[model samples]
Target: MTQPNIVIPPAEQQTSVEAGDLLNSSTAGVIVERTAQVRNGFHAEGRKFARMMAEFVNVKQVGVASVFVYEETFGIKDKLHWLIHLSSLEAYEAMVHMGTSDQEYRGNVSSEQVSQDKGGGGWDKIFVDGSMQETVLMPQFWGMYGTKVDGEREKQTSVYQQQGPLTGLPGAREQVPLPVEQLVHSGNCGLLLHRTAQLEYDFRSEGRTFAREAAESINENLPGEATVFVYEEAFGAADRIHWLIHMKSLTTYYKVLALHVKDERIRDLYFQERIAPERGGGTWARMFVPGSMVDVALTPHHWGMYAT
Candidate 1:
């Protein structure tokens, strides 16, 4: 059994060692290198994809969403600026209309001045004068004018003499003997004479004459009772007279009196007696009396009176 020891061949030994080395190299090198290459390729593709996406995002932020190829087809950039400025067509139209010239705008420029040179001078004056002249030529006008001028003048002269300065004084004449009976009767009659004389003198004064004359002319042919009375009495007296005359319509009478008198006290008295009662008390009965009768009864001493 010891005579033949088995000897391993060199070719077999080489084969066995080489096979083990091939196994180790496959495990450590080939698999790892393939995996690393796959991972690197994936990362490179991911980075390129992210960069492309970022380019599109930047274009959109700059108001150019599409690239050149898409922009040529869509015209997006051209319309973007317009869309931002004008929200709607109607708003744009309205702005345009407001900026345009209009007739009202033109009129505003022309209304600042009025001129006689603009057909408002000699022609207008001629027309007015002609109208006035025609009015004066009417029969009613002449009648009214004459009565106002002449009748008023006479009446006013009478008033001035009665209450004016001339009548306030006294004068004496040569004495003559009188009967006792005549003297007794004259006592009462003298007062009446004095009043009549004073009235006559007042009617002759300038202011009274003018007022009476004007009143007569204006009131001539005026269809109703025409009378003009003058007084220098206090407001209370004037109010009493107005109340009596304007009983039918205190407001109407008050207005007429106010126009003629020009005295504030008289106006107040009229308001107190006539206007207040009719307005506050609702007294229609007292307000319906004719002014003439009231005037006659309340102011019998007045300088003038006419029945109609």
Candidate 2:
């Protein structure tokens, strides 16, 4: 599909997904990275502000995701990792562009680009300026699966679950997945696990095979438990692949991690078998967005709740 080229005006306060939307675009989803310590009042406020802009500004609603990663290796609860999904890079830039406009920009667009345009950076008092750590994600090949049939029960625990349907993107509704509710259940909370590794060989040839093997493991053993995503680092610490796991329940979330830690064949493929080696730097985290954060969960028209 030819992605529409969209250039939103700064301060326009209206959303537009001229380029392909993120939920299912093969080449979309710019991992919006921000260095944030979990539960800081200002930082959390900044995230919510940006999300509000995306909800109100664009021609179509785009999601502002807060994906938190929990890695036992770090044992640092003070630092929190998160991902806010904008429709595209342009959409992100435009959202931040509001910072340079007439009104003060309260949202933390990226850690680096906080504006002095309004009161010489005083806005950080309410919302700290943080930089967007860059990353390379796998092309959107890992998608929602195990869909709930049309008349079956729907499971959605997203902050945006109550938000309207997705629009301006393929696979948002028609293909890829269906009614956002099916992607996850309502009572559940979400957790994201991002693991970055340095490849010893080309994953396209070798790593992919291992990934497939791992996927098969999930399907066979931990069925309907989690959604797995592998991302190649495009910006942060060079040469890294981030593996993201989105889970619905705390029960399944912990189970999958325990499974990975003990499983030998899966461990051999990456660790013992020598495919991708640790770069001595990576994080595994379980991100949970408060169900009360309805403002943060507001998503775009084309957004999907889950695969099933």
Candidate 3:
């Protein structure tokens, strides 16, 4: 990211004031400070809420001083304070009328003619007054478990510069595979994982029966023990599935089959049956009821499959 340009005007051309002048003058200025604890989340006791502080300024002849606070995070703007204007009753009324008629007014105050530059220049002795504090809370969670299929383990080892064979071919150098463990852990629900020999199947019908029929067809035809995972749309699940299958005779290695369905409910039902219950220790391979693999064997052209 490019750094923001910080333009500092010449000292001679800038205006300066003391805290006393700011409280007494009928002009506008801003009060800025560094804060380590800003409110975050819906509840108190949340993690670090640090923020840079800025207060909009509106000065008046009266003793009332109104300060509005604002904070920006992740490129989003949020209002943290209210419109405060310190002025006499008459002055307040006039400011309001001016604000209502003037097109250039940017301050949130209801009045016009009140100076809007939070002191336009800068001020000294901007002492800290009593603070208003609030507690903030943030929540997080995790789930799921699986082993990295052999090929992925090999690839990860190669990238990490671990001592390993340069290639998987036999009669060549036997590289040491990296030591990486596959385990179940808590995480978001929609992440996708890519694995070998499995193809994504897209169905075009609008009902659960159609999906079940398709699944049965694919399950029956593929080599026994071949792993298959079905997803309605790419990235629909937080963590995607990894399939393992053998296909030495086929030219294309991994097939991503697209199943187009007109009914959303049918697609959802299919997904739920195929991928939702791994948490209970039931194996995905076993989830394929008999006859699930029959569709792929019959309608090779009606479905679209891509190899990765």
Best-fitting candidate, scored by lDDT:
2
Please list the C-alpha lDDT of all candidates, in the order they appear: 0.21, 0.36, 0.24
lDDT of 1 at 262: 74
Question: How far out, in Å, is residue 151 in model 3?
Answer: 89
Q: Tens digit of lDDT per residue, candidate 3, span 66-177? A: 3322221122122122213233333445545655665534333222221235332111112123433321111100011221222343353323353674221110001111
Residue 41 alpha-carbon offset, candidate 1, angstroms: 99
Give the per-residue Cα lDDT of candidate 2 at 57: 39
Q: What is the TM-score of each candidate against the true structure?
A: 0.14, 0.46, 0.16
The TM-score that candidate 2 achieves is: 0.46
Of 1 and 3, the candidate ahead on TM-score is 3
lDDT tens readout by residue for model 2, 12-101: 112334332323212235555444442343443344444444444333334532222222222433233333444555556665665566
> Candidate 3: which stretches are off by over 4 Å?
1-17, 24-66, 70-79, 106-308
> What lDDT score goes with residue 195 in model 2?
46
In model 2, which range of ten residues has the least summed lDDT? Answer: 292-301
What's the lDDT for residue 110 in model 3?
25
Across residues 1-308, which tens digit of lDDT does each residue of candidate 1 receive? 11112121111121112222221100110000000011221332222222233233222222211111000011211110000111122333433453355444334323322234543322122221222110000001111212233444334333234664432111000011222221211111101000101112212232233333333332331112222222221212221111101011112234344444775543343343322443444221233323323211111111111110
